[model samples]
Target: MLEIQFFQKIEFLQHRLVAVKKSVMVKTRKVFKNLSCLTVISYKFKGENIMKRCAIVTADLQNAAANKHAARIKAVEAFLPEHTEFLNKMRAKGIPVVHLQQIYDPNDPRKYKHTDYDKKFIEGSHEAAILDEVCQESDIIVQKHRDSGFYDNNLHDVLQAMNVEVVILTGMQSQICVQTTAADATFRGYEVLVPSDGVSATKPEDTERALDWMQKYVGTVKTQKEIYDDVLAGELIGGKHT
Candidate 1:
């Protein structure tokens, strides 16, 4: 009878050990499953949180009726209202707006005899100064020496500080200053958006050609109305106010 009782005790102890081992195995599997699920959730959340950057680049819009043709001035004047509205909307949304003013130094080594009319105008007279009517006190102004705003300018640094990833280009001489800046921005890995109505050239044909080229290579060309609507819809980089 004593021997039988001892064997029964040994059998009961073995059964308890087996049950504990099974419980540990089940808990370990559950922990591994939870860790895998957390890893996937982390990746999905990161993918959905990517942010975008945006800015506006305006060229010198000075009054030069005598230097430029009367027709050119008329074109610029016609576009002013629309441009102002667009800029105001951008400002309201807290988007960065950069105005590029052309400046020239008589003694600067970069000046050349056959430089473009835009460059020559800056080098020669007061017409290079940005037109006061278009520039507001609140706008950020950047002075540029060449066609491209980035050339010898702190535009890139400023954009970097602002975390700008996309540039919405506008201003005078669509085929020259605007195009040059857009191309340079593209080369520098920035997305560019040129509103068809926000920019104008010396002639309609020039403007069309520039837009075509930009659409083909440099950046996306959109209409001002489209962008404004996007702004209103709260679909742009900055949240919509109205």
Candidate 2:
């Protein structure tokens, strides 16, 4: 009778140990599965909410022709007051704003004999200097030699350092400088925003074509008022515009 009782006790002990082991295994597997699911969710959220930097590019607003041309200059002038207001608001909000100015160097090695028209517009020429009235001391200025602001310029570096994700373009000669810059920005994977009223070209048709192309291929096109409203409403991130 004593031997039978001991054997029975051993069996009961063995069964309880086996049951505990199974429970532990099941709990471990469940925990590992939950961890894997959480990792995937975290990765998806990070990918979707990636932050981007913002900047404004102002092209050559120098010569009288750019400021006085009936269609080009007049259009820009009409929107100047509101544009300035929006820029000021952006500045107050701590958004990065960059102004691109074209500088012509007569002795530049890159200057080609075939481009006489370009040669004549030397650095000190009326066409090269940024318009005095429109440019402000607070604005950050970058100089470029060619139609594209990115060509042999510090634009890329500046934007990179600032972590710029989007560029707001405004300037003269929409068909040339503005278009080239917008295309380059898109190629670099930066969002581009062009305010139709903030830019001008030598001709209405040319400006229209450039704007249309940018809107279709490069980035979004919005009016000055829309931008201003966004800023005022605090829709933009970073900081509020002053």
Candidate 3:
């Protein structure tokens, strides 16, 4: 009886010690991990102040106007002047902007019935480059081969790394790239928004339908000014800005 009690006491004491050791190790590991993230961010991004948990994701707004699709050019161009001004305002608020550009690849997410001849979006073409006016030094550029910015690209990974929760979708071809990217963002667990005034399409009806479709499956569609006010007020869809 005495021997049995001694062995049981030894086992109990061992279990207690093991649990205490694990608790200490867990706390130490959490501290180390936080320190690691701080070190990496401090070293990599020197002076740029990163506002946590939100970003502006813009789809193809490439230059080399002559090489663009005529219909897309005709429609999207009408909103460029306004879009440009909105983008500048958004970036001024310490919001990180990610520019998604499509480069030619045979396996692009969407199959185009149109020819690729004289296309500005082909790889190695300046026509595929971002327009100079909206370009900023702090912008993160993600080159993609697909219609959705998330398709075969580092966009999601980059956003996750930045700890982003809300993604504001902006850019050209309301029914195509903008719509597709927003859908992908929804599927990938982002709180998505499309400023109605920030996008354009080949026709007014197309843009309207795309906006309706996006609101149903992807996100809310609001005017840029409305979105900007909400952003400033910190009342985004998913949660308040931190």
- Of the two candidates 2 and 3, the one with more favorable lDDT, higher being better, is 3
Task: Evaluate residue 50 in candidate 1 and report its C-alpha lDDT on the 0 to 100 scale.
Answer: 35
lDDT of 1: 0.68
lDDT of 1 at 30: 50
RMSD (CA, angstroms), candidate 1? 21.1
* TM-score comparison, 1 vs 2, better candidate: 1
lDDT values, one for every candidate: 0.68, 0.65, 0.68
TM-score of 1: 0.69
Worst 10 residues of 1 by lDDT: 1-10
lDDT of 1 by residue, 179-217 (tens): 999988877878788999999876888999889877755
> Per-prediction RMSD in angstroms?
21.1, 20.0, 16.0
On TM-score, the stronger of 2 and 3 is 3
lDDT of 1 at 204: 84
Q: Number of clashing residue pairs in every model?
A: 0, 5, 0
Predicted candidate 2 versus true structure: per-residue lDDT over 1-242, tens digit per residue: 00000001112354432111111112243543434221111111222343445777788766644555467667667656666666777777777677787765666777363365555446567776666665667667788877888998898887777777678888777899999999888777677788898887667788798887786556678987776565556544442133
- For model 2, what is the alpha-carbon lDDT of residue 24? 15
Residue 176, candidate 3: C-alpha displacement in angstroms: 1.3
Residue 56 lDDT in candidate 1:
83
Off by over 4 Å in 2: 1-52, 64-76, 107-121, 124-127, 233-235, 238-242
Write out the backbone clash pairs for model 2. 53-165, 92-241, 92-242, 93-240, 93-241
